[model samples]
Target chain A: MPVEKLIFYAFAALMLFAAVRVISVRNSVQAVLFLVLTFFCAAVLWMLAEAEFLAITLVLVYVGAVMVLFLFVVMMLDVDYAAMREGFARLLPFGIIVSLMFFGVLFYILRDRFFGPENLPPPPPHGADYSNVEALGEVLYTEYFYPFEIAAVLLLVAMVAAISLTFRGRQQRKGQQVSRQLQAQKSDRLKIVTMASESPRKATPEPAPTDPEEGQS
Target chain B: MDALLAVLLIIGKILLILIPLILAVAYTTFAERKLIGYMQMRIGPNRVGIRGWLQPIADVIKLLLKEIVIPSGASKGLFVIAPILFIAPSFAAWAVVPFDAGVVLADVNVGLLYLLAMTSIGVYGVIIAGWASNSKYAFLGSLRSAAQIISYEIAMGFALVAVLMAGGSMNLGEIVEAQSGGIWHWFFLPLLPILVVYWVSGVAETNRAPFDLPEGESEIVAGFHVEYAGMAFALFFLAEYANMILISVLTALFFFGGWLNPLQGIPGLETITAWIPGTIWLLLKAGFFLFLMIWLRATFPRYRYDQVMRLGWKIFIPVTLVWLFVLTLMIKGGLPPWFGEAG
Candidate 1:
């Protein structure tokens, strides 16, 4: 078999295994881990498809950041594994029927395409030394530049919205003023005032317990 | 048939080179300790062998003889596999590294990319090790390491991009050849900022001080390898040193003119002989940088985690980006003839 075919098979096998385990596993944490494995297998398949940049981005963005945050949430939550397992039989028949219907319809709709003849010719060799990253960059920046900028603006807006949502007004804590902090000077608190020396106090009064009950005791 | 036999013969030759290289890695620990000990005003491992020459061998034997202890509640399969995952890449990378002219085991076109891929794969070992141990400290250490490696890798990538721009190639041998003619022709002088950023990023990437927050001995308790014992710990140790050596070799290749004589135009030296092998020059340059790594490790304190991240992203990344643009301009205009070379 060719290397690409071999890689495809390997990734497909891993994806299948992880997908099965995602449903079969009793533990939710393990299911999430299986999901992560499925993502990883998909990434590997992307790599085998000559999408090097995409493959790495998938690993970095999804595996490195997304799955980590997922793991963090999973670890932090007080998940009731036993309770989650209950009512499974009650839900199974309906779940199976719905899943089968979805899968059957999806498969039926796509079967002709899946087993179809090679209608399209192989893409042109994309010029000598041209890479997918460069090609994508050229297309994104040239023809779709306005849309790209719009998408970026959308993302920026979303990011700001997210931050503002988290930024609540907490009155109790002391908030820092950047300008004041930066401009702080020692002279602001210091004073070299001259004063006449006073005589030391001869005696200091000591107070006893203030309550009349203490005096009676 | 002759071609096939020659290929087999070449394979045999590579194995011959590799066996000694592996042995050298073992002894590099001894060399590192002895050198560092001398620097720190102490005698290291005098009893291990005669004058401690065989200390690494003795240490290897000791580690081998020691019991492999898997902690209770640890994921046994993953825990056992982690060491192999860590060390395999360290050894595998030697295939692409050129010891001399046409002397590398594998001279693939995408050598640098292969190295990068291998290094990235190395993170899985740490992550798996941390998760398998079932200890919070180990897990936290691994997480920190994962984050550290990923963050610094970006900075490192930028630095390499500058070098790549200067050389116009990702092939390691081609990069080295482009630095030929003299030390001044090397990218380090023209691209000094990139060189500095690369070195700093390399230090962070390998988890060496003062960037070694992951394995801050006082804090994370040896980081991801906390639960590993005997041979397992040795594997992590070997991986760290191997990474250090790898980065040093890379620095030499990118900046210091790998396999090129620095003393190119010295009057009497030029007259004496020109028959010296290029690999010696490369090894010496790489060795000097390795020593510097150890010196920095001995002298510097580990940075706080936040500080490490800040330096990588907020400082190194910007500096590298600016210099990368500068380098691109210089290469486009063609730098002065004697820029990196100084007699």
Candidate 2:
């Protein structure tokens, strides 16, 4: 078999195994890790197909940034495993129906009706020095500019929504006014008030002001 | 036969990278300690060998001799896999790091993105190690580290995007080539703010102080790998140093002009510096950055966890984003003579 075929099969097998392990693992953290592995394996498969830009961006965006947050949540939350599993039975039928519907849509999309290799084979791989970044840039900025702009705006809205949903301004916690701190000078917060020694106020006779005898007297 | 030889050659190249990398990782730890020691007006680890040069090796043997300890309630598979997960991506990142002009293992088109991705993947080890250890300290450490790394990664990526805009390529070698000709030609001149931001974020990304909230000894008790021991612990240690080296190399490449002599613009000094090979210059520049990192560690106190987060999310991110925009404009305007070919 060709080396590329060997790599393809290897990555495909690993991805499948990891995909199964993602759901099967008892530990949520481990399950999340397995999901990461699945994503990574799929990226390798993309690499094998010479879609270097897509492959790297997948790992960069999903595996790198997004999944770190995913693992972060999974690792930190004290998930009650038994309680988590309790709703599985109730959700299973709905899950199955939804999954089946999704798969049906995918199948219909991939079938002879709209798309297949018979209809349109994948684009030929580019040689070295063929900058996929430039090609993608050109296409995104020109042909697909409207869709791209809409996607960017959608992401902006989602970002605003996420912040608004989760951000809570609390009065309890001490706030750092970074700008004020940066702007402060010694002269702004300090002043000299000279006084005559032993004139303004007399020292307390007893240093221990908290003495019960003194308070009572 | 040709295929076998090619495999052998690739293996040899990997070994060549590893041999130096391992040594550098080992020595970087020693250097950090010694530098900190001098800053504090004391000697560090002088007993092992002459002036503690062999201390890292001695430390290595000690770690190697210890038994790998697994906590009773820890997840077995992840416990074993965590260190490997941490170290592998870090070492793998060097594959695309150009040592000299045209001297890289994998000259991928999206080399910068590849490096960013590898760096991003490294946080998994900490997160996994924390979880697998089944300790609260480790878990907390992992969480802080995870949050810290991701926050800084945004700034780091934006900084690199600025570099990408100026260089007009994601390839590392091409980035270096664009900064060729003179010291003034370096991206550091025009993109000073981004350079500072990148290195600061680099420090945070490497989990070094003052951004080391995850490993805060006073609070977190070594943070994510609190329960790790023997080689398992050693891998985290190695990974941290390797990451430091990675950051240093990247800083050198991006801002300082990797493999380029500093006095390139001068008439006769250029010839004088040309006697030295490009690789040496690259290493020297990387070393300077490494020393700068250690100096910062020695000088500054550790940042409060909240402060670290604030710095990354609020300060660094906005600054880098603005600089990235300014960088695009600068390239378009052709304001800097050195950046004439950019954009």
The TM-score values for the models, in the order shown, are 0.78, 0.91
Overall local distance difference test of candidate 1: 0.78
lDDT per residue (tens digit) for residues B54-91 in model 2: 99999999999999999999988889999999999999
User: What lDDT score goes with residue A35 in model 2?
Assistant: 90
Candidate 2 chain A: minimum summed lDDT over ten consecutive residues — where?
A197-206
- Runs off by more than 4 Å, candidate 1: A1-11, A26-78, A83-117, A120-162, A168-217, B1-18, B105-110, B264-274, B337-343
> Each candidate's iRMS in angstroms?
4.0, 0.9
**lDDT of candidate 2 at residue A155, scale 0 to 100:** 99
DockQ of 1: 0.11
For model 1, what is the error of residue B194's alpha carbon versus the real structure, in angstroms, after optimal superposition? 2.3
Taken over the whole model, the C-alpha lDDT of each candidate is 0.78, 0.89
Instruction: Give the number of the best model, judged by lDDT.
Output: 2
